[model samples]
Target: MGWLSAGDGYEVALVEGRVAARATAGRAAGRQLKSLPKAVREHPEVDRLRRLAEWLDRHAAACVTQVDTWMVSSLPVPTGLLARVWPDEAWQSALRDLVVVGEDPQEPGFLRDATDGGELRLVNLDGETVRLSPATVTLPHPVLLPDLEDLREFAAELGVTQRVEQIHRATWLRPEGLAEKATEVREFAGGSYDSRFALAARATALGYRVSGGYASCRVRDAGRGVEASVWIGEPYWDGDTETGALSWSDENGRTLRAVEVGPVAWSEGMRMAAALHAGRTVEEGRTA
Candidate 1:
């Protein structure tokens, strides 16, 4: 909900409030960049951050302005650890005000935004809709870091203790060193790289055909055994936004089973694949 200025620091300003300054990513460039931190600049997972930062620099002024209290389209911070910074009072206040005047935009494949604007709105090229709800807060990109302390604090202040656990329900899938393989599976699985690839590789290695969402020997399953299917799409419901759920069918076109697998990272997904290859299921209905 704030903008990092072009100067030697970051400047964050809320609506109708004074702009505040503190050393920011700019400060990191000098001391931190004396040598790129392996975890950030050198790690394969962080290449996107490096690439995005380069793109943002090319369009500095335009990019910075995207940081409204409700919506920011550009990738300012890395989707990983950089997003885990302690939530300062400014951000908490802005988010608190945001929860009151708007409903969360939970539509899949549609960009949702919330800010100090009159109300919470979900807009697409078709039109826009607004609602008043205090039990709502727009879902931001998941904080990729493992630690959830800061996020817990924010949720507590918002009086949404459930959100603390909800954060664990989302997943991120970035396949390092397997970019080409990941790309192939993502396309086949309806952009579900994590679940599909993780499942497919393990199944194929164990002898099965790679189908739309599952690796099975038969396209249809009768009543003999459970014929399953997984749905891959962004999930949003009841103000909770996690990755999609996995669905199964009985070949009679009747729903058989479905289970949710909270958010999963690519690295974690791969581990699940390894488990499947080892003849172990990951304690979830979805593949990985």
Candidate 2:
């Protein structure tokens, strides 16, 4: 594999005529190609690598989109299918470290590895690593995972972030003791979408991550971070979905009291709600 300039201060390496990895120009320049001219910016090989890099990026995105779709729709995915795609770096990156359940949905575990023999390696709730050869596995939504909070903490300690939004999706049950302490910053109504995917698309366009039927964005202010999330329904393509509620949470997945929420977070949450509301479709009988 050799490094080549991919333009815009980025560099990619070609491995067997395929883009293997990419990095900033600083990292790509060294003993391989000390100068930009020697990098052969217009070489056919460099062009091929650039195209391969774009293709790989799209493939990775498609993999993540499909996996997220499966999780939201509660669809079953065959183990053999996963094993087949695991060899592909993009697909593997999207599938790895996600919470998956075997044929029996009740027994969910964290996906660690997929073997060539069509077997899956996972870490169970009891913190045990075991190999499973079920006919199929399902990537359950974060809401369906009982040990989600614990898993999130563990994942944070390991510095593992999933592109599929399993561990990073913040969730919290309304605390009874904090009921009096809690406050509502904004309540939006009449913001509805034709389907969950439509809302997710808008959220994704707005630079938020869709996870567990919600579109969430994280903001850091004055060294403190907060996540603002707006709930959309499950990923049923034809099913109607509407904004449920907007919420803010701390880094540890604890819901923040309205008073505790900063102005930046509040405004951002309202902005997201309004943006989603603007995209709401008017029913046939309703007049705009």
Candidate 3:
């Protein structure tokens, strides 16, 4: 933000998301000060600038959260909608470099830009710039992408780093013909924590809901919604605890078997479970 009149000779502006001061008329004219002068720090203009910075921070976070939801769910987003928000730096950062599929699922490209007319520019795998104006596009989850390893290799060569995780995200595939009647996965269980609060805290920090002894996250996949849950321990339990089996349930609360879980759901469920497990307290002299 540009400097604004704060007082008789001082001007204030937001520098790198923080309020900074400068002398508009004096020996250090036009020079930014190392610290805010005592007088300028309490000025109304500085307070206003501080509030604006805070709002910008929240706006940026909200943009990232929205884009993350779209990618995680692999939901189809209208080209028009992306074009509307493309000019915004926060939205652009969260979207750029994400893989997008248009009318033809066979062709996927890294998102580069969105035009005023809703056309999208992309960098395809062959190092060619391409344009697409499909009515909608899907940011398929990593597990659903074909030749995922190849995409990772290509992205690395280009130094493409996404603000949100996608191509390089960890994923797991459900084993084929696993017990059709089984409703739980113990692969991430047996993780020990010092207390239930610690285990629950980790889940909460990971953006999973902690309620009634279960840490869970909901995802939409394969045209259906499902919730993946892992037992963390009862609320208010102060004793040491350990993670329990992971499981999936439909919107109607019907537990799904290992074979019944969809690909994205399975991957997301495992991701959540593993993240919670990774925070377990390790014993000394043993690898975490």
Instruction: Please tell me which predicted candidate would have the highest lDDT against the true structure.
Output: 3
For 1-288, candidate 2 gives per-residue lDDT tens digits of 556556555465765435443445465533333333434467565767678777877988899988866764446789999999999988998998888888666667778899899999987767789888988777865655667777777776656668787655543333234455765534565477877788888888966788887888776533467888888877655687887678889899999876676655665566677777777888799975
What's the lDDT for all of these models?
Answer: 0.33, 0.71, 0.92
What is the Cα-based lDDT of residue 49 in candidate 2?
A: 68
Whose TM-score is higher: candidate 1's or candidate 3's?
Answer: 3
In candidate 1 the C-alpha lDDT for residue 282 amounts to: 38
Q: TM-score for all predictions?
A: 0.21, 0.55, 0.97
Write one digit per residue (lDDT tens) for candidate 1, span 132-218: 324433334333323344444544554442212233333335424533322122222322234434545555674444555444332
- What ordering of candidates by lDDT runs from best to worst? 3, 2, 1
Candidate 2 regions exceeding 4 Å error are 1-12, 15-30, 170-186, 190-288
User: Mind giving the per-residue lDDT tens digits that candidate 3 earns over 1-288?
Assistant: 577999888999889889998998879999999999998888999999989999999999898888888998999999999999999888898999999999988788999999999999988889899999989999999999996888899999999999999999999998877886899999999999999999988998888899999999899988899999999988989999999999999999999988889999999999999999899989999988
After superposition, which runs of candidate 3 have C-alpha atoms over 4 Å from their true positions?
none
